[model samples]
Target chain A: MPLSTVLTLHATTDTTLPNTMGHLAHAAFLALLDAAAPEVAEAVHGKGENKPFAVSPLTVHREPCPVGREGDTRGASRTAGRGRSVHGSRFTVHDRAVALAAGQECRLRISFLDDALFRPFSEAILTLGQPTIRLGKAELLIARVTCVGSDEEPEARYETYEQLVNRLPCTVDRAPCTAYREPCDADAHSVHGSRSTVHEQLSFRFTSPTAFRVRMAGGERVNWPLPDPVRCVRSWVRRWNEFSGFPFEEDELCAKVEGGVGLARHDLRTRMLEFPRGRELGFVGEVDWHLTKHALADEPFLRQLHTLARFAFYCGTGIKTAMGMGTTVCRAP
Target chain B: MPLSTVLTLHATTDTTLPNTMGHLAHAAFLALLDAAAPEVAEAVHGKGENKPFAVSPLTVHREPCPVGREGDTRGASRTAGRGRSVHGSRFTVHDRAVALAAGQECRLRISFLDDALFRPFSEAILTLGQPTIRLGKAELLIARVTCVGSDEEPEARYETYEQLVNRLPCTVDRAPCTAYREPCDADAHSVHGSRSTVHEQLSFRFTSPTAFRVRMAGGERVNWPLPDPVRCVRSWVRRWNEFSGFPFEEDELCAKVEGGVGLARHDLRTRMLEFPRGRELGFVGEVDWHLTKHALADEPFLRQLHTLARFAFYCGTGIKTAMGMGTTVCRAP
Candidate 1:
């Protein structure tokens, strides 16, 4: 048979008791549980249609309320008049499989209840006592609840763990599961699928006083012994549908500077240096990655590509990051 | 004596009436004489200290102003009363060399004065008329004046050649001189003194997929391939100090892209390209020229440098103009 665990219903806040547990105490309890048991955290916090709790999974059993003994009415009346109860609810550990592992004791020894059960109760009396249970049983110990408390400290009043659990409208099984994991560190190698390839280049030009002329194919030309710095930047872009390997081959980008002296020439030189080598530079040195349409159909590949594009946009001009200095000038070609 | 030449000043605006020749008549007469007899465009529109009566150095002289009889009260009274100027103030060409160049029968005519002189005056007139004299003889010829007119018509005004020249203060002798020269057309060889040398270089980087590692003197380090396109631009700047050879030793004076990638890797590649010289992968080209410092310190050189710098800056950054892009980073270094 599956292990049955006790679910404790303890009153965290008691206005009647000075310096006792309060709302902060209850919040701390949840935070501690989350830190200690990530699995429990995941089970409680999992996103779904119904989110009951933000803790891990467990088969919870609530403790039963103690019955009044015969001829004990007078004692009960006296306690009831004082707004306190002597005989409180008691839970027993009957399932050996659910017992805590050795050396894995609860450090805070705190109690937890479904928020839905506690949220409706105005006042309650909480009694935390050692559980009466058999060793090696499949049961695990949890807190018990007693009588209802005064109106002045309504939230402090408590009900039996059984009563609280039974009052809940939804089954524990219906609660969404939380699968928490450790935070990712920056050093981990990024996982890039086969669909994407990253390309990078660095080019340089030198000034010569004696050169006659420099020429490139397709009528591109640069006169030697350049009078001033001439920087040319260009790129090509293609829509996702029209992406082809030869997209950048259709046109060339070109820029030239003439006039004035000194600062103007220097400005021209610097302008060329920062000009985007792709579309921004009139499609001068553009290359198409030629991303296949099939790749886009894959969700993960598409997601990764989008992520990379976002990263590039954030980086801007490339100098700020390890990406160096460059321009973004391509779509899938 | 240096050869003398005759100059002519033609009024671009019409001012052929009399009586309009008031206080300005004498000044205008002096201006015409200075422009014509010397055949100098001094004080010509947009030239030297441009004055009232101005002439174009390129304009050919046809007829000289007629010399009026001394104390010719009849014509003076007629001009003063009618407020119309016929012939403006004029002077004879006394220099024998200039007279002989005009030929025995040739009369030097003044034409083309800027239009600015007539705008302020209501009526413009030439007092003296048909005053002619033989060559090599100095004689007073024309007189003119201006007055307020009753008509409310808007006056036509424009910058006169004399006014333009006058506005440009003479600083050729006082301003610091430099040996700069403007760059000729692409086909023309740039002329430089013995002190000038030119430097240039060209470089390329393998940006496709494989060249992601940077090997330096310290160690081989893998670099994250840039996710964006990269471009390389080159620029040249002039240095002012005199040096025995090239001032390459002055690191600050050298225009360069630095810090993004370390120099060790760049230096190694440069050496490989220089040594045993053959084709090599990951090899880009570079050129450098050294010019005499004095040669770079001229207006033409400065102008060319400014133009080049502008081009470089534009191309490097892919910006259309210098206005919108943030402050330029190009400097003397």
Candidate 2:
């Protein structure tokens, strides 16, 4: 199994600017990456003297611009004149570049540091009798910089500017900005400004491609068979309950068996197993046995057997868990 | 000058008994010593023993038996029958002890624990009329312990009865029992009956007093003035505020400066002053000057000074503050 890494991006701007904002936005994005993951920063920048790490596949999303007011031409004019507009965007780059595994979905939402700036603009547009874009929804276009004659906006500016604000190449949709009290929606493209404006960008790299492995032969997979440990434990406990005449509902059985296995495994992993190097080897076996044996054992004898099995599993999975286990296999090969 | 130690007690009991419940109200008294000088525990019950230390001068007060009550008839008949009763005699010890402190104008108050046993009793008493016991204007019985006595007749005979209460001696008014919620108001005494009545008394040697010196001549001798580095630092801060032209009223200034110097000195003594043998020495010097020179003169100069002084004050007071100072103090003197 591989350790999965999640990357989240939050963009905010006080003033409106066109594609020019992408340069600064990109810098901020890179800074966030460095702050969040210094090891990834080292890999991106490089280890040599004076050579900074390099970041790649820096995905950017442009959320819909909120609708502006009709009467308040001043706000629109200001945005038009400044040539910089805020199209709040969110970009996420998984640690691994591989496509998401089947049945695995990553849910993300927009997070804004300062919503005050966007509030005035939102209010200005709402007050005016104009098609105000929903605050958070990625649909309204306050300003667009494009090639001299693009299909979307015929009177454009630069050649590649038209290609910059295009839809992201991945499955994307609008998400609510719950952090903000106002009803603002977010889109993927809003994160990175027009691509033509960004000169230097950050990217990601896998230190080892085969660090995680998902093996189906041995029933080792990430999120396979729904991976509902509670269900598995409940089913096992229900079988025992029926035989023993113990009155218990599915939820109760699930809770008791799952909680018991979890608590026992946690105790064994934390208290019983001691690694001098401070490595978390014991947890791997504990988790494996807890999921496969302890949680699913019905017979009293089997329950005892499962405890020992969980202990052995802890020892076996120790190394893999420490290295990071996921569906994606990232190895030197 | 000695450090003025304020004793406050809070008690809770099941409310059912008549006004007679106050005698068993002992938690507030014990809590007073626990709050004022936790180190007193070591003094009374040798080092490492977990027994309460301080002894209160006030004898536990018990009200006269109410007329028409089952227990009252027995108590009143005995008092009239024998010219004196054992229960009444037992309470005489508390009255005599409290009389000494009362004569000295010491602050006193009864802290009644709000327990189920005391609820009905309190309600009935308050409904009928407030019980008043005046020991001079200076030393008034505040009626602190209003709890529930056993439902069994108060005069019920027992081969040997245990007094399930803990007591501490103090010179301050008890805190209102209602102010503290249940559970917290119940002390070990209320939870477990008095240890002395049930078990063979075990004797333990008390620790020797750790002498602390006070340079009274050099500085103003405020109430309970002692060389507490913490209070010293706090006083220095107040002096600084005054010098800085902050408008601090008399009560406010006194409250601020009262224990500040002692607290600062205490912290400096335990934390900053260290010897090669690992023995720590208390800081010596003017409160304002020492803190200003050593701890406060760091980054953000003035702010740092205020922070250190505030921290010392907080540590000494054992209260939470922005300075982040409250910490346990342990020293080998």
Candidate 3:
């Protein structure tokens, strides 16, 4: 059961919501999961084990922000206030009144690394229509479930990343999608080998502001201003190998990026991102980058590398993918 | 080995060429094949055998035609004369000098059912760049090869046509894509079995004018202006079974369409198509039809039927898929 599912929620009431809606959206996604498969949700977000899913930030579809900083800020707002009647979890937006209009829409997509959960999730989504949900001050009415699909199966081994990206849906912009790496503790045990023949180009468009989290020497978690490419790639590879039902170990292959052929970020700027839970101040920003000549040292791991890379496009990369962070669009070159 | 290849040819000449360019494209395509695999071409088109491929008519990208038909005709003219030097087969545009201008492009896509041939064909295409080739009076310099890929492997059984179509590339438009069958001879052997639970809706945009060739009572082949729904579905099913490397027959199944359900052609008109060999004055025309509830009698055949319908999209239906005919865009519902 090798599959990747994407669900498109078309908002009937407001689509012009602020980018910070990721928090509210993430709460609703969990509620939906709990409604569909409480056990599965418990297994994913419950108290001890690791999760097998990633949720993208709310991808808003609307006109560009108003001209000046003041004007743009006026068009989108966030406030802090508790819900009158809470179920499961309560999310509140403080004082911000600006939101998506009646006819506008936005998208909240989640990828299940575990294919076994697809059916329950799909069934739950199909039953959700016109659910009155509040993001902040605005109440949203979902018009329809526009699109839901599993990703195509991975292609033949030795296939280039440039050739694989075009086949995946929701990919935006052009090729050369890349993630930056500056070393991290999660991968403290990671070994960086020299390059191999997996020379391919990839492009990613950070549709929403994305952030990464890493632990400091004192065991305190902190957001990394710049994403660590090696850790990002490792997560995707590890998740895919475990849930794809065709498991492989990192120890079986040598994976590394050729030195000096570094990642190039383009046309991006940052925004201070806040969510409903108010646990931390996250960041969101637009990003476009290119990754070329990223190689896996072992010849036998070529197919596994390609499969994991392709999965990265759907499941996204970085921490809190399930909480609306790390949403990306990697186009095939 | 389940993959579909789409070749996007960026023309270094005018992009607004007429639909008739399919002739010149066919000539060049055969030449490319001859260069890559002469023996394969001979086996496909040579001797007396059914060709196992389909060639779509040249898909041109251009500014809309001029206001007056006469003005458009004046802008592009067709003059008849023999090729100064002929090779394999000669193709002439007949005094037509108004070809695609530089900086514009056209697409010539071909689908091969033989998975074994993908490698050699892919290699041959990658090596072609800036090849100065004459397509009658129009000389085209292929600026770049934009995209090339093989179709994804068929999804697991019990998959819906909707699911399968989305997994394959080259599908456009909305769902519930279908074809209308008004009744035809090829379907004479087609038993209109009573309906079962195999309900589905499909939409197909015949990018090229699609025609069907079926044998009459006397065993003579005739062209079908209107496609036979039963035969169309059957062909897709048969072809998919053969190429998917999974063999299954519907010996215990009966299939039928719901009453009053029919096909609707959108923005379509007919044209008398001619080829270089002058074997026959073939008719080709644009087709956009939606097929629904085209169900199979048995529940078990549902998966097989879905698989075949998806194959129809890549392999196409009817004859001469390899010579620029039967181009299609079948979208899932």
Top DockQ prediction, candidate number: 1
Worst 10 residues of 3 chain A by lDDT: A79-88
Score chain A of each prediction against the true chain A by TM-score and list the results: 0.15, 0.17, 0.62
How many pairs of residues collide in each model? 146, 108, 65
Model 1: per-residue Cα lDDT over A252-316, one tens digit each = 21111111001100000111111122101101121112122232233333333333232221111
Candidate 3 per-residue C-alpha lDDT over A137-225 given as tens digits, one digit per residue, 9 for 90 to 100: 55555444433342321211122233332233231222222222111112211111221123333334554445455442333343433
Better of 1 and 3 by TM-score: 3
TM-score of each candidate structure, all chains considered together: 0.16, 0.15, 0.36
lDDT of 2 by residue, A230-252 (tens): 43334233323332233345575
The runs of at least 3 residues in candidate 3 whose Cα sits more than 4 Å from the true structure, single-residue gaps closed, are A1-19, A47-50, A63-98, A127-137, A147-199, A251-255, A258-261, A264-269, A276-298, B1-333
- Estimate every model's Cα lDDT from 0 to 1: 0.21, 0.23, 0.43
